[model samples]
Target: MVLAGRLRVYLIALWIVGSGSNIVNAAGPVAETSTATIVENVSYQNITALPWREADHRFNYGPQSLQFGGLWLPESASADNPAPLVIFVHGGCWLSAYDIRHSYPLSTALADSGFAVWSIEYRRSGDPGGGWPGSLEDVIAGISHIRQLQDFSVDLERVVLTGHSAGGHLALLAAQHNDLPSLDAVVGLAAITDISEYALGDNGCQKAAAGFMGGSSLQAPAAYEQAQISVDKLPSTVSLLHGEQDSIVPLTQSDGFEHHRLPRAGHFDWLHPQTPAYRLLINRLEHYLPEHTP
Candidate 1:
């Protein structure tokens, strides 16, 4: 096993901590169980800046340099006692500007909670052979390679596929394919489900849909059609997690699909270990792939 490129260590539990002191007032109606105060500790810059542990191991699914992924096993994990696996995809509007490193905090948090996380690094829009089918293909290869993953200890039966933002879109696209092995669940954190509509938005991220897709929906109708998700074709177990306060990708993106929203959370709150949104996500994951105790 290769040593982590960054510091590799265990993370502490991030349960609900602040009660009255840290609570921030959300403008609109709060969700049923919103612990909004947790948003204080989570933001794109905040999460990426946190002192997080790197993956425990690294492997390449393809020859491309960007085709590699990192694995983070839980403390109790071993070949004799395999931990469940979570395949992670990070989102940066499908741009090369954002890399897999930003998602380490989330992976580290999941590993600490007893799941083995494999965060994939695929080529992005600005990179050669990246964007559209290439980006999606890399993600598919990363997930499919797990069937042949060796040395690392993981429960294949309990595997889940998940991604954030653009990554979520790819996760859903990949899971819907017939070639992939059966998965326990697929979760999207603030995923951009409707790409055609997203491409028209004025926000910088929304406009990036064109960059990743090669053009506006009008210019590349086929790519847009292929990239847009069909909710009916989704897996038996799927969850769309959106943050109401998310300005990067609007909560409306989750419309027409069954989803859960965090009232006080911004997009990055879902990745921050200390946030209530993150806690709820871990709870949802447990429900989908409960720790196998024999």
Candidate 2:
């Protein structure tokens, strides 16, 4: 829970009001559903400004030909060095409008803090390029790819999955089944955590979630189920960080999510950035991950 993390939630909340609500129609030929064709040699816009010390690629389940890239922060040789891996997924409400470029800063920050980082970029929504389960597939692929690489410097055993907004939603959705090699922890930063509540009206994000899910919950029950970020899907030891004032994806989303979650599933830490609660939450997180190392 960094100071910037709190600021991010607050800022996105303000934009939720002004953002227009409209579903984007398909743009080009729809890419194969569940069939991910990796765009090879594709360079990510290195927005981190941090010197890229080292990077590599591994296709978890998609085309190995695609040249996807990610950074690797190796642990210190000393025994005291922390052994943890953090994978960051970017948020764009499942649209191509946003990409991994925006997450570089956060990845860099995590790397500087001694945690190995993987900032992923997946095919986004709006037809042609990507949509629906495609984004979810890519996320699973990215994590699996990392796991398949035997020589990856980061400790796969202590891995933590993290995301902001839509990425947060995906992170939560990913946790539902305990399917992928079993992540140690899941963290959502002001994530789009609840689908049913968000789609009730016409805020920009609500509209995006509705369209991304392919219609109202009633019309697309299956799609809604697939995209739902309910607490039941979350891991037993998940960590969620959000500003109480977040408007884009209201804080209530997190509240509503926990409302239905089984007590044994997990407990959420809802921190307000405007108060001392933010620092306390981060302190708890720092210890929480280490304390709950499974």
Q: Backbone collision count in every prediction?
A: 0, 6
Candidate 1 lDDT by residue in tens digits, 117-203: 989999999899999889999999999988876567888888889999999999999988989977999999999899999899877
Task: Tell me the lDDT of model 1 at 104.
Answer: 78
User: In candidate 2, residue 137 scores what lDDT?
Assistant: 71
Off by over 4 Å in 1: 1-37
lDDT of 2 by residue, 138-179 (tens): 777776665664465556667778777788887778777665
CA lDDT of every candidate: 0.80, 0.55
Single out the weakest 10-residue window by summed lDDT for candidate 1.
12-21
Q: Could you tell me the TM-score of candidate 1?
A: 0.86
Give candidate 2 regions above 4 Å deviation. 1-61, 64-69, 74-82, 127-129, 256-285, 291-294
* Reference-based lDDT, residue 7, model 2: 13
